[model samples]
Target: MNAQAPHATGRQALFANLLFWGMLLVGGGALAACMLVPAWLDYQAARQAAWAAHARNDALARRITAQQLQIAHHQRDPQYNERFIRQEFRIPTPGVQVVTVEADPTGIVAPADDAERAHRPAEPVFPAKALATARRSPLLAVFVLDQTRPAVMALAGALLTGALCLISGPRRS
Candidate 1:
């Protein structure tokens, strides 16, 4: 008689159950990781982006503040008036001597003439109110916006959804 050892009782059932539980554990772990990792990464990226935006906003604010200070200083100084006049009118400074010497190819020296520069144009005054008005444009409502918050939640939700799909099995048709 051919003899064989009897199969262990309930071994097939045990194996099936073990396999199902193992698959569940592994699948669940993968799903959880897929969800968690991207969320974490997205959160980090969003945080960094927000910080960068905040830095940019702060820099712009500081620049605006500095410009305001400059305007205030100019209002108190008359030299700024002269400078602005020079810029606005393209006028050269009076009483400042500019000497130019011409050299002859034949080794002859030509002396610079002071007579041509003896007479200088008078400087004109500019309206300060225009400059003040230009400086005040920043205080207008059109120049500002509410940048204290930005839209980043959509990015987080999208990442979470993509991760969930990746970890979960495909749906049956």
Candidate 2:
């Protein structure tokens, strides 16, 4: 009986360790879900806001570039400037007679023209230049833990060694 006691005790210890470890894993997983899920969601929201800001900034930059080009055009082209002044500003030239035409009120009265104009595409808030491909994430890669740290490496090595020992069990003489 004394000769077998060591092996019997070893088996019991191993069983207890396994049962305890299993329970710890289950509890740890639940705790992680409770804590980490909300944090991850918040992180996602922040990331989205950051991306939106970038989109707005890009759109503004493109708008600025277009405005600069327009200013350049206005400065360089006398024909464009004159046409823009005449058409856009409604400024009459010195002698050019302008004609005004209106739809005959006596003709068949049509319904409000809102429906026809509704089909015209609305202006986009963000320009196509500002749009980015929907990738996994526009932000930098994120990690829950720093894997490169010496402490982390040591911990991983220890866990691996312990797992190997657990799997092998007590060595037989």
Candidate 3:
């Protein structure tokens, strides 16, 4: 008599289960990876912003400290006056020659005009923006969600749907 092996159905069920489990594993892993991409991108942006803010704050603090020191110098130093300031800046100082030269293309030094340079207020320097971050790529922006709150939810839903279908699928004899 021609008949199928007694364990044929059992073998088929085992293979089917292995395949379903394998797909679940792979799909879940992929989803987790996808979810981490957004988080990683946000982390990099935050790090850059933090560094910029720290640098700006440090620059401003140093400027304030320098100004305070200057004030203290004027209050404490006995010789701190208009003459002293001018001498410090080498302005109108007798017996001292001031020379400014420009480098010529022919390697010759060309002295600037004989006129004394007038002291003007220094140019204002504004600190760089603290909130500036790297620009996002247009293609990447489409995939990066604002928030990845439910990282595992999608994997879970996919697993459940696949499992239900696999279990309830019609069986052939």
Candidate 4:
């Protein structure tokens, strides 16, 4: 009986040790899997978002190109500036003057005749080059797209860091 007791004690001790190690391994594996799996999901999401952003940027580039083509077409026309001025400012040409005739005596104004307008020289054409220069720079869209990349990277990096922290942290208690 005494010999059997010792043998049983030894077996019990071995079982206890095995259980402890098994629990440690299982717990650690679960922790690691939990952390890593979520991180992978986040990475995938970020990659998809980045791809979509790239598509959007490409579309924007196409839109800008179309706008540039339209602008070029307008610029190529010799009378574009003249039409623009006439439509925008409602300014009459030098020979075609605007005459005002006041119905009331209180207003002092008189309408002029066609002979005065005939002597006047034609209105000079307005140049578009100066207006183009005054407009905003074309590189602004590229700069904005360039700036967004870092922010997207930062978001994905943060998610990875958080997942790592969860995996490395001590179990429940």
Candidate 5:
């Protein structure tokens, strides 16, 4: 029995060391995954939002510049000025005829004139540069781990720690 006692003590010491190291690795890994992964995902989302806003700003700037050019052109044209005044004030110019078209009660306008449609600008396409920029964002291999809830991650860590400790058997001292 006395000889067996020393063997039991030795086994306990070995298990205690194993438990300490296992807890260290498992606990550290879990802590890092729980905190860092979510923060990284959030940062990625914010960056994408900012890039979209920048692209929208560029599109609006181009539209505004186009509008300014149209205004300048209008200001230089006597015909446009006369038309504007007549349209706004409903005043008739001498020797000029104005035809009024009444809208249907259902409120849908008749098809626009082909000439009017031809002069309208096309809708802008999404910028290729923005798409390329988004595509170039770095993808993390650990992102798969992010899908698990933080609480679940914590629970898994606890379970693993408990399992390892159990495998190491009871503490001696």
Candidate 6:
């Protein structure tokens, strides 16, 4: 009976130790998660923003490259300016006269009511240069944040979580 009593006490102590370690691990994990999740989310947001900015910059660069190529082509071609002018203005060549014939008012009548115009969809205008100029680079913004309070907060949270975890570890008998 005396030997059995010691065995039961030993089992109970072992159980208590396991439970204590389990609780400590769970608590430490929870604390670390709480500290890390927001920072991780913020980092992801910043990364996504940077990627989006990079995509936009890439698109702009492609567009500028295309435009530059077109300009270079036009500069190289002697007849390009004349062709452009003729296409744009519908100007006749030398000794050629232009004639305009208007349709009879009775035969072709314009819409009398303003409702038709109001219901029509407006033309979609893309002012690419304006948009590009207006937007700040996401990489630059991220760099700024890295140098600011948010980065410090994240670092401090990580350090604190690590310290807590170490403190909560199983003790040596």
> lDDT, candidate 5, residue 145?
38
lDDT digits (tens) for residues 91-164 of candidate 6: 87787777789888788776666445434544322223222322354433332332443564565456556556
C-alpha lDDT of residue 33 in model 3: 52
lDDT of 2 at 54: 72
- What value of lDDT does candidate 3 attain over all alpha carbons? 0.60
* Model 1: CA > 4 A from native: 1-7, 10-14, 95-173
Cα lDDT tens digits for candidate 1, 1-173: 12322244356546655655665555555445434544454465566566666766676678779999999999999999988998699787787765678776798656645333323332221223223332465432111112211112333344445545444635323
TM-score of each predicted structure versus truth: 0.46, 0.42, 0.49, 0.42, 0.54, 0.44
Better structure of 2 and 6 per TM-score: 6
lDDT per residue (tens digit) for residues 35-93 in model 5: 66556555665676677667766767787799999999999999999989988998878
Write candidate 2's Cα lDDT for 49-73 as tens digits. 6776676667667877999999998
Give per-model CA RMSD. 21.1, 13.1, 10.9, 20.3, 9.1, 13.8
> Which regions in candidate 2 have their CA more than 4 angstroms from the true location?
1-14, 80-173
Which is superior by TM-score, 2 or 5? 5
Please state the error at residue 5 of candidate 4 in Å: 4.6
Total backbone collisions, model 2: 0
**Which ten residues in a row are the worst by lDDT in model 2?**
126-135
What Cα-based lDDT does every candidate model obtain? 0.51, 0.57, 0.60, 0.55, 0.65, 0.59
Model 4, span 107-155: residue lDDT tens: 8666766445434543322223222322343332222233543454455
User: Which should have the higher TM-score, number 3 or number 4?
Assistant: 3
Which candidate model has the greater lDDT, 2 or 4?
2
lDDT of 3 by residue, 141-172 (tens): 33343343354456656875786678788987
Model 5: number of clashes?
0
In model 1, where is the ten-residue run with the lowest total lDDT? 141-150
RMSD of 1: 21.1
- What lDDT score is found at residue 111 in candidate 6? 65
| Model 3: how far residue 145 lies from native, Å | 14
- Regions of candidate 5 where Cα sits further than 4 Å from its true position: 1-15, 92-150, 156-173
